[model samples]
Target: MIDIDPNGTGLPGIDQLRVIVGAVMTVGLILAVLALIIAAIVWGFGANSSNPHLASRGKSGVLIACGAAIICGAAVTLTNFFWNVGQAI
Candidate 1:
């Protein structure tokens, strides 16, 4: 019989890697928030100016920012989910 252990501490610098990844995710989320804010401002300005093209661009930007935030927040969960699915195969 063989056994496998998947403890995350098996390698050196893993803790550092975790720290870096955490920092990156934090930065990503912050950027997403900033983007959302900027996009909303653009949208409001465009609406006030009666510019359909600008408003459309701002709306797209808002959607993209929201999507980015969602992906950033779910990165770890998504990775784990895929990992488990792959393991089941």
Candidate 2:
């Protein structure tokens, strides 16, 4: 039987890497939410101005922001899943 440490896999700097990844994820999520908000505002303005091209751009921006949010939200789950896979190997 093999034992794995939840904190690390007996590798140096793994903990620091984890911390850096977590910080990046947090910042990414914050930026994604801000982008979503800005997209919504732009969409509103475009709609009010009757600019289809601007509205479409805003819509695409909103979609991209939502996608970023989804990825960021799933970061922990994805990390855990990969961590477990590594442990099994």
Candidate 3:
């Protein structure tokens, strides 16, 4: 049997790494939110102006923003899940 723990590593600044990652994720989520809002506005304007191409682009932006948010929010959980899966293999 083998066990691995991140904290077991006597490396300096490991705790700072966690804080940095958290801050990065927070920034990502904030950016995603801003993107979503801007995309929604673009979508509305396109629809109102009857510009199909613009509308399609706006729709894509909104979807991409949502995907970013999902990924950013679940980043830690997703990493842990994959790590466990890798360990089982």
Candidate 4:
């Protein structure tokens, strides 16, 4: 075990790790936003059209976005859970 100060005065590796996680999460969030925007646009434009295929495609896009969001949420939730368990160790 290593001593990690609450302030930035200890644990160099831990600090680097936190930076890496932040960058990864930021990119994930950007992707999530893009997915959601695409889903919304598809749905909105599809609603105004009479083509069933377009509507189906819109629904598919929405489903894909929902899936992406769920995966992201699950990953974060599981990570937090394991992190907390680790802290108890």
Best by lDDT: 1
Off by over 4 Å in 4: 1-14, 80-89
Can you write out model 3's per-residue Cα lDDT over 1-89, one digit (the tens) per residue?
Answer: 67876663488888888789899999999999999999999998999999998888899999999999999999989999998898789
lDDT measured at residue 60 in model 3 versus the true structure, 0 to 100: 95
RMSD (CA, angstroms), candidate 1? 1.6
Candidate 2, residues 1-89: lDDT per residue as tens digits? 76747656678889889899989999999999999999988888899999998898899999999999999999789989998898777
Evaluated against the true structure, the overall lDDT of model 1 is 0.94
Go through the candidates in order and give the C-alpha RMSD of each one to the true structure.
1.6, 3.2, 1.5, 4.9
lDDT of 4 by residue, 9-31 (tens): 46568878878987887777678
Candidate 3: Cα lDDT at 49 = 100
The TM-score of candidate 3 is: 0.92
> Which 10 residues in a row give candidate 1 its minimum summed lDDT?
1-10
| Backbone clash count for every predicted candidate, in the order shown | 0, 0, 0, 0
Each model's TM-score, in the order given? 0.92, 0.76, 0.92, 0.60
Q: Write the per-residue lDDT of candidate 1 for residues 34-55, one digit (tens) a residue.
A: 9999999999899999999899
- Model 3 residue 69 CA deviation (Å) reads 0.2
Check candidate 4 and list the clashing pairs. Answer: none
By summed lDDT, which 10 consecutive residues of candidate 4 come out lowest? 3-12
Q: Model 1 misses residue 50 by how many Å?
A: 0.6
Q: In candidate 3, residue 75 scores what lDDT?
A: 90
